[model samples]
Target: MNAPAPIRLLIADDHPVVRDGLSGMFAADPAFEVVGEAADGAEAVRLAGSLEPDVVLMDLRMPGMDGVAAITELARTGSPARVLVLTTYDSDSYVLPAIAAGATGYLLKDAPRDELLRAVRAAANHEAVLAPSVAARLMDRVRPPAPALLTPREHEVLTWVAAGATNREAAARLLISEATVKTHLLNIYAKLGANDRASAVAAAFTRGILTPGTGA
Candidate 1:
């Protein structure tokens, strides 16, 4: 059987030293082919189109048209090459935008050499990969808004209030005393950041804890 073709790579970074290091590392591995090097995002985009590389090792910050913009443009133009961000910046400001702009993976420059190679291979296969720190940041970004501080009882009270049910009615339905219902309402108001029933319901809706046209 014929051996699998080597993965073509385009290294993009402003620093020549970084590009040289990555190119040499991949060159030693027969599975990866160093197709070209780019000094910045614009050059990366141009080389990517011309070389049709399987993967692009891109840096987030560059002289012109930063990596996120290049990734976005590549996606907009439908380039098949997968971009794997290898950068020093792991902050949310950098990580979120690169992923949003269609980066296939994100890895910090401090990643071990083997891990970096694996990331490039994974990106070449169009699989999503992220360095441990980057993954944590992304999870923090997407994690469901910390569950509303309200308890289940508070939620029930708020729902009833939204449905125009009086405290007495809600208490009766929930098998609780009217005084208890009032206490629950007060807690709900505090948690929802509202001063009154109307504002509480509106806030609940805005917070996505309550569906519109449902509590009614």
Candidate 2:
């Protein structure tokens, strides 16, 4: 029997040390083949188009076009590569936008070697992966019932949010247009003091408005 093909990877970050380190790590993994590297987000987008790696490990705070911006372009440009974000900050401010822009996973740079490898493999396969704590934190945002600001309809929307519904999915569930869903979300943000989807959910949690339940 022969070994299976390694997952192709592209590492993009501003730090040379981090890029080199990641390349070495991937090389050590028999299942990963690091095919390209980029020193900035703009270069990352460029290399992604050229190398067409299976997964791109992108740094968030790059000099140009940042990770979220680059991921958005990747999605818009119809790139086949999957994005897995690596950032120093685990805050919702960055994570939520990255997800919206089409990153399939998120991880902090301090993540363990095993987990990082696993995340890359999962991203290559189009699966969402995150630190367990990050996932739990995101879940908190999806269903926070805070400040009693949501009307029944807003609450309905929030429930879909809690269920991880994108605006399109939420709109479909509510039998409304996607534009209307965006309108409702804007209002929800105003009422909830939320600047983004993650913050809105977090506000709900802080206000004791949403609680997760295990099916009994």
Candidate 3:
């Protein structure tokens, strides 16, 4: 039986040191072959077309075309190379776009050598690979935010406010100090992300925290 051929790789980054380091790292391993290096997204796109590597280790913040654009172009042109995003940023601002742009995997620059190698291998095999942090960030980006929590007192205060009661009246009705009513209103404003009583009432109604024709 013959051994499988090495996975061809293209390293694309704006930093010379990163490219050099990656090249050296992969060169040390027999499982991978570093075919070419590109300093920017445009060059990456160009080199990817010519090299026809199995995988492209892309950096997101490169000048000119950027990694996302390169990934987009590669996909648009139907390049067979898989894109493995290797960058320092794991924020939603960075991770979401690259994935949306057609990255096969996302690994942070700080990933361990073994993990990165495995990720590259996975990418070469057309498997999805995501750093733990990147995966978490992606999940958070896709998952809906938790609904706002409101205390019973805050709900009551909002209900009274929504019923068109003045603060003094609400205080008298709730048998609480006007100052206490004001405090609850502030908390409601913050929880509901409302600028004022009217907006707070509106937000409460919108969120189903308050029902129409209901009062405290």
Candidate closest to the true structure, highest TM-score: 3
lDDT of 3 by residue, 1-216 (tens): 988999999999999999999999999999999999999999999999999999999999988999999999999999999999999998888989999999999999999999999999999888999999988887887899876589877888888888889999999998999999999999888888999999998888898888888876
Worst 10 residues of 1 by lDDT: 140-149
lDDT of 2 by residue, 105-209 (tens): 999989999889989989988899987767977999997655556777777787788778898998888999999888888998998888998898878778766
Residue range 1-216, candidate 1, lDDT tens digits: 998999999999999999999999999999999999999999999999999999999998999889999999999989999999999999988998999899999999999999998988899888999999989887887798776578888888888888999999999989999999999988888887889999998998898889977673
Each candidate's clash count: 0, 7, 0
Q: State the TM-score for model 3.
A: 0.72
Error of 3 at 123 (Å): 0.6
C-alpha lDDT of all candidate models, in order: 0.91, 0.87, 0.92
Pairs in clash, predicted candidate 2: 141-201, 144-204, 144-205, 145-204, 145-209, 145-210, 146-204
Give the range where candidate 3 is weakest over 10 consecutive residues by summed lDDT: 146-155
What would the TM-score be for candidate 2 when compared with the true structure? 0.66
